[model samples]
Target: MPKLLASAYKELLLLTRDIGGLAVLFLMPLLLVIVITTVQDGSFKTIKQNKIDILLVDKDKGEVSQTIHDNLRTSDMFNIIEQSNENEAQKLIQNGKYQLAIILPENLSNDLNLKIAENVDGILAKFGVDESEDLPGTIQIEPKEVKLFFDPATQFSFRNAIKSGINQMVSKIETKSIYKAFQEEISEDSNEEIFDTESFIIFKEIIPNSGKEAMIPNSTQHNIPAWSLFAIFFIILPLSINMVKEKNQGTFVRLRTHPVSYATVLGGKAIVFLLVSLIQFALMLVVGIFLFPLIDLPQLNISGRLPLLFVVALFAGLAAVGLGLLLGTIAKSQEQSAPFGATFVVILAAIGGVWVPVFAMPQLMQTLSNLSPMNWGLNAFYDVFLRNVGFIEILPEIGLLTLFFIATTFIAIIYYKRKNAV
Candidate 1:
């Protein structure tokens, strides 16, 4: 036990001696947390602000078109700008300058009036206009107006607000037409059911609101958060590659000759690298707290399982270091060890939900994820943070991760002994 403790201590001191390793153990995670948090927060803030530019081109310039344009301009939803033509509007959209553009068609008023006239109480209404300007008795015309185009950039909040405003303006015109038809039918002594039958067309069944509207789609949020945490955890690979660097520098031989067993030296190195992983985890957690509203850290009700969660996180860090150690110890040189460590970490991280969430993946991929410590570690974090689970909820994950640490550490020990035996 004393020998083991001494080995662990020596490994820890050796890791601490490397300035680059110390920086990685402490600073790299902090940097990643800062970056991800900034991006996530900025994106959500842009969505909430609901600021989108729209270009309007009115071809008709008629009263109805003007009214439609005015309606859009008056609303707080859009930053409406008048453009000379559709070409400029499209150019702006292509350049990502505007979210969407509205184009008013020529004769917009006439088209609306044509629809209005169809429901008019008239007998001698002609469908086509005469080519010759012949003398006519007189005719009253009503116009139907429409928005020729809508902006695709306008999302639900902005679109809904615009839709509501337009509906209000059009409802008055529609109501007058309805009243006129009702009076005509009443005068003709038609049965009430005839009018009632038409009323059904206007009324629709109400759709009940579903529970807990997600801020973003569940799949997007779930996968992003899960993978973000996975990256932070997978950083252990680069950190552990330093062991191979030490071996190449002759430090490994010198340390072994200084009355230290192979286990003590390697064990200490693993602990130091493991410490680095933990620091990164903490930095990510801090960034999540300060930077992204998507992650409600303080609200995470994992008090009952905090201790267990910490233990799991710590063990996961150790497991990552152990994997790195096994690879580094087996490789011929630091150059070889570095790439192998990086590739291995990346593969494990990918499978573990660093790049995607297991739940959102296919069944085959989900099964594959079970082989990665990252998958288990991230799933446990999600359980504590999102699902409000207790220690019992994550026991299996913790146990799996603990076993991974033991297995990897054993492999690393055996490999180191074989490679460095004097």
Candidate 2:
């Protein structure tokens, strides 16, 4: 007990003296979280709240074009600007001045109405409802094309959404025109409406909550947990570098002459570094809770999930410390440990859904992400923070992290004993 405490005290002393290392462990992650959250929040707002400017060229100059314009204007998704020429609208879209442009072909309204009227007259005549003998013969009318121009930089998904929306709007208009034609043919004597144009099916979004308050995940919610895990695991760089330094400085040789096991030495480093990880996590929470609102970002709401968050953070710290112990044990010099530790942490974060979300990744990458300890920690954090899950529900991820710590620490101990056995 005394030996362990002494070892822990020595590690703490060493850590406190290295001002630069302390700053790297603490400051870098806060800046990363804040910057990433701010940028992502802005993107989210742009997609959901901001309206896009679109150019409309109505060459037809008739009811169909007017209806299209009115529908687009009322949708609230676009700021429609009427352009006189299709070529001008195309030039504007190509120059990236606007993301989208709609060009209604000349005579589109006349051709569409003629086609509908001919079809309706034929149907009514077949049903013996057309009393007039002067019904016009079947006339072939070519399909009118509505040309859409998109900016070169437009995303494929955004383009597809625009195309679908425009298609649906046009289809509805055509259906309404058919209904009016049928009403004119059937109810020529009466002025009663035949078809209801109102939509019956609509979509509603449902967010799962913990029975207290609805927790809609924003950029703050996503980024805080992701970057916090990144910061925790990044402790490996400093922890491993410290180990390499101690070895190069003959501290390990001096400690070997004393009555101490390698396990005791490892325990000491783990305790201090684990505390550092926890402190890093706490600082992140503080920044998220207090500092975010000052910068016009959403405040992170932990509410009743603080204890569970701590539990995940503790285990995540253990996993990080175990990895550091293994890295330090294997690496021969500060040069080797520092770069490798930093790079490996980044790779882990990349695969762990820290940078790109797991769901957004390709299937093979998503499958591979499960192997990362950071993924386990991030999942546990999300379960507590976003999903509002309890301890029992988070056991799988917590268990995986615990096992990772045990395996890495065990291997590190074995390797150390074997290396120094002579």
Best by lDDT: 2
Q: Runs in model 1 with CA error above 4 Å?
A: 58-77, 82-84, 104-239, 249-266, 286-309, 347-372, 414-422
- The clash numbers for all candidates, in the given order, read 10, 0
Task: Give lDDT for model 2.
Answer: 0.92
Reference-based TM-score of each model: 0.64, 0.94
Off by over 4 Å in 2: 126-128, 131-135, 189-191, 210-212
Q: lDDT by residue for model 2 over 61-144, one digit each (tens)? A: 999999999999988689899899888889999999999999999998899999999999988888888888898767889898
* TM match of model 2 to true structure: 0.94
What are the Cα lDDT values of the candidates? 0.62, 0.92
Write model 1 residue lDDT over 1-422, tens digit each, in one string.
Answer: 67666666766666667788667656655565556545655566555556656778878787666776776767656677888878877877767667667776787666555544444433323333323345344355534344434455556665666556666655644554455454553456543333332343555654232342213223223433454445545554555566666777887778776777766766666665666666666555555445445553221233354565566678677667666666767777767876766677678777887765567789998899899888888888766555556678788987887888788778878877776567
Compare the candidates by TM-score and give the number of the best one: 2
Candidate 1: residue pairs that collide: 7-264, 11-268, 11-269, 12-268, 25-276, 112-143, 112-144, 113-142, 113-143, 113-144
